[model samples]
Target: MLKTALFGLAAATQAIALATIQAKGSKLFTSDGNQFYIKGIAYQLTEDDPLAQGDQCKLDATLMKTLGANSIRVYHVDPTADHDACMSAFSDAGIYAWIDVDTFSTYILPDNPEWNETMYDAYASVIDAFHNYDNVAGFYVGNEVLTTGASSIAAPYVKAAARDMKAYRDSKGYRSIPVGYSAADIADLRPNLQNYLACGSNSSESLDFFALNAYEWCGQSDFETSGYTFLQQNASDYNIPIYFSETGCNTPKPRTFDDQAAILGSDMADSWSGAIIYEWIQEANDYGLISYGPSAAATATNAVGGYTRSGTPTPISPDFDNLSNHWKTLTPSGVSMSAYNPSASAPSCPAFTSGNWLVSGNVPLPTLGDAFKASGSSSGSSSGTSSGTVSASPSSSRAGTGGSSASAAPSSTGEAAAATSSAAAMRNGVPVIAQWAVWLGGR
Candidate 1:
């Protein structure tokens, strides 16, 4: 069996190499002729926290596989660790990975010969050690270095890092790997949009793709409405393709499963190069769909009410059923501006269970961990109104019939239990979420 797995890995690597992937026309395509909008979520190491309220059992990779998602943005890349096994899991499962360099400072300090040498060594080590991992798609050179611009800024590090790494790869005859960098959600947030966007030199050299991390905080409009379009316009001016590395918002609190899907799916459709959601697992701040709970969630009454951190999870998105409802209206229904109440803010929410430990203000949006608290204190009462019409208003938050609240956090465990109970429940007004679900089961 050991020999067979190794043989299978080698075969898989060859298959991945032979798989012709195209980065063209505002989207990507696979050899199988599948149109990829880069619909995916950022999976995290959050569940690894021993005291996390998450259900450990439900955190399964299979959930991502079933969602039709094509990629995952791993936040860290440590070459010496079991990264091969990590990348291999996704590779074998047919999921793409956008691996990130360990730190923002690494990319920014390239001008300093000493720091440059250190950064280069770390980068080269990972590229050389893990480049063979079939699932590795691209390198996310720097994270949000531009967000907190100052003497501490790391913009220069990018140019130097890219040059050094590319040179090293070429020296070793390393194969072609699509290179890229991500900007803080808004273009202006990045120190220099004009130059940063030029990281890939119009996708001609320094980079092959561009990434943006747009988070809709208290803004009345989707970031894409202003953010993506502006970048897309610039990319058009530069003739380069842009990928929204991360795009999501938190206005619909107690986020129903469908709402979760809608927020993520909408941005993907809105962007030209496609996008991936902030996170894949629940963190201290938000409910990541998958987790583990104690014992058998396989049975009905055996389930614990809340925060078991026990069962393995399966996730389902909030907007899983209402595919057309998402992002179709640039702003979500509950958090948009309106002619009736134009003065209303986008609505605020509380921090997660563990978030209390920090000095929390209204965070724009976290990197990829527990991204949001419940949508709003009003529980999505004041919906977001945008140029599009599908926006739901706060007046609609009432539960007209008997069931879950209109804005309950999406839960796959509920769906799983329902699944075993009867087929009739699934069809009879019960919401169905198409996203991933991992049952968290713990001791």
Candidate 2:
């Protein structure tokens, strides 16, 4: 009887562990083959390692679960900190994490972008830190890196970062964690920037997924009027998973979140995966669904210009209830991985215009070391000279209901080894702890 009881408890623990999310063509799926939609919130408290606060994470995870959220997007974390407690807390609550690999100092700057060794080491260290966790959904290479037409010159470097990161993930014998980018919703940069990042003939060079930080749908707006119709139509033929990395515009007094219906509803679910709300806390930007500290102390300000509060998470009344209500009613059941077949062809690389897209469609992406190679070309020894066009194939017919048609890639077979001590950890010729100190001051 004692042995049976212990085995049952262990089985229950394993049952609750979050499954790995995989990108199938333009949609996302769970390891069990069920289609997955991200009902997520953007969670970042400090500019540094937010996940390092395990006690706070435990408290917030319970509140998020009550809010009906299944995922959280964390913008930054200390690669060297122990995340077992927080990650385990979220996983036990059936929540997954979509983390950003680049830190504030390591991110590629538009004015002076370069995919060098320093950036590569920083990104690789983060991956090494979190890749073992089953609850990690994916990693964003850079967020809003290219906002304007002139800044579009940095496109190639961004692509190179994705390429090298994917390569490092593969070479380390780690699971095939998806690597992607998040773009600012700029009218002129749309479709072009999206196409450029996923355009390369080489599958290795193309982003595993793409995301956009959109806020066009303000309070009390419908799908067609909010410009989401145009956004969906443009993404109808995209070949990889795409979603709203950051959303929820807070202009009017109280937000209604009407766009939530259109996003997870039949209108856009076929073309898009899901969305993550702009924020969790009421900061200076004022998009939080909840605030921290006592209700009377909500007015207190912090040194960084955000609301100053700590302790229990206090939901900001109607805003919290509004989002919770939408999530409760709108449950989208996407198609099963077995039934779906991906037919969207790779989009043709966008042509360059003087000020709009500075890089020519034919120009090779910037390369790092001898790791990157164009789809149909040889290995790259130098930078920006690799060449080849990934030929476009026939397009598939759009589905009326459920997820769009797309074939699922084989699930990752790599198993994580036991965690090693920081002193002994080494990857790509750099000690993991040494890299952490250089980039994050050993946070």
Q: Give the distance in Å from residue 101's predicted Cα in candidate 1 to where it truly belongs.
A: 2.1
Query: In candidate 1, which residue ranges exceed 4 Å CA deviation?
Result: 1-36, 46-59, 103-115, 148-153, 187-191, 194-205, 217-228, 254-271, 294-311, 316-443
Task: Name the candidate that leads on lDDT.
Answer: 2
Report the C-alpha displacement of residue 302, candidate 1, in angstroms. Answer: 22
Model 1, 139-228: lDDT tens digits are 766554343222112243343455456566678885555666766543333324323434331233344456766554322444354344
Worst 10 residues of 2 by lDDT: 393-402
Give the clashing residue pairs of candidate 2, or none: 341-405, 341-406, 342-406, 342-407
lDDT of 1: 0.40
lDDT of 2 by residue, 235-296 (tens): 88999999988777766758778888999999999888899986787654566788775333
Per-prediction TM-score = 0.55, 0.79
Candidate 2 vs. true structure, TM-score = 0.79
Q: Which has the greatest TM-score? A: 2
Clashes of 1: 79
